[model samples]
Target: MLTAPIERMLFGLSDDHVIVEPHSGQLMHPEALVAFQRLSADARDAGFDPQVVSGFRNFDRQRTIWNRKARGERPLLDSSGEPLDTGALSDREIVYAILRWSALPGGSRHHWGTDFDVVDRAAMSDNYQPQLTPQEVCDEGIFGPFHCWLDKRIAAGESYGLFRPYAEDRGGIAPERWHLSYAPAARELQDFLTAARLRDLVHKSDLALGETVCEDMDAIFERFVRVPERCYPQENT
Candidate 1:
């Protein structure tokens, strides 16, 4: 429930442009970088050197990904188009897809440089199915080493002031088993990144579409982004 002090800035660069390069290992907050290094070392000790697959992105990058999914170029949804694909999606369809796999740039915890997405390097490929479930990946056992490492880190992270925002919240956003946040800054960034501000930025920027795009985006924000802030108290306390 901590409040981030800095104003949200747009950092949504394309997946290809992420500083992580071919591996998508982009910029991370110093603390998170340290934690990741520790996590990586631990994973290696456990017989796996998990690599970071994705990290900080800018709005432009997020938009690119969203657009690709909308065009059916990227498998943002499932085969039946159920949860992941969601059927003949328009740009509006891209909204949920973006939320499910990517964030709206500034809205993403990675943009603040405090979050990262870890994946097994050996299994990941250019032909990788973006919508594949973690369980599916784990079935290969390649992800096991990292999972075991995460179990230990999750227990010790709080002491280092790191926490998982998307942890144990399967009902809302898909649980990103690999996504971890540096809690001290992330708690505040969560509040600072609001649906209203994000919408305004998107509109003012090049990501803005036609009238339909605006309306659809408005709806998407209400449904997916405008949750109660950490400072909100039940019944106003």
Candidate 2:
């Protein structure tokens, strides 16, 4: 099933799924952008200026992020959300740790151009640093109102075809309250990207911790790649 077209589209190697848009200042799937704009307008009308901080990310971009985190060039956090000493962990452990927070190259939802990290730009100070932490979206935090508003509007979002991919803390990835996906397009890709396909790709890819990551393909796939539908946002709706 990992044919050339599948490989290209899944890895973000081709531009078939995305288009350049001035409003996003990045590439996005045309349908997704339209839905996002509607969501943005609705948020604005509700008194929040929501913006997409991250849109489409190709495999190479994700590789850079993975590699940096693996090599300790970037911060690696533990499951408890505390910083970890990557230098002390084995390469295999490093791989698992990275997967807790990031997808492997060619395995990220952002590759689909239908997933994005959104935030309320109006809520932050000009110099506010974005940590995307759980605290930041909690009831007392700065973006708390934004996430609360989103929670109420999520049901209404079905009309626009958008939903959160990580609305809850599933066993695999941490809960990313900011990550939204256009269900209409992303759901197809999700069904197509099975663990077997991901395992084959991981073995062949020059991923940062490829050897260790592939050594336990079944567990890795179950935990990171082959996420169940219950983990998606529609469950909340």
* The candidate that achieves the highest TM-score relative to the unseen native structure: 2
Cα lDDT, model 1, residue 193: 57
Candidate 1 C-alpha lDDT tens digits along 1-237: 212335433234333322332335366666666656766665666567566656665566666765565556666754223555446566655555556655554466666676666776655576865443566444355565556556665665422554455554433356666666666555555655555666566667555232344566666554454333442211210
lDDT of 2 at 208: 74
State the TM-score for model 1.
0.67
Worst 10 residues of 2 by lDDT: 228-237
Residue 188, model 1, lDDT: 50
On the 0 to 100 scale, the lDDT of residue 19 in model 1 is 34
Every model's TM-score: 0.67, 0.90
Per-residue lDDT tens digits of candidate 2, residues 86-149? 7689888888888889987877888989888888888999998777888888878889898888
What's the lDDT for candidate 1? 0.54
What's the residue-level lDDT of 52 in candidate 2?
Answer: 80
On lDDT, the candidate that comes out on top is 2
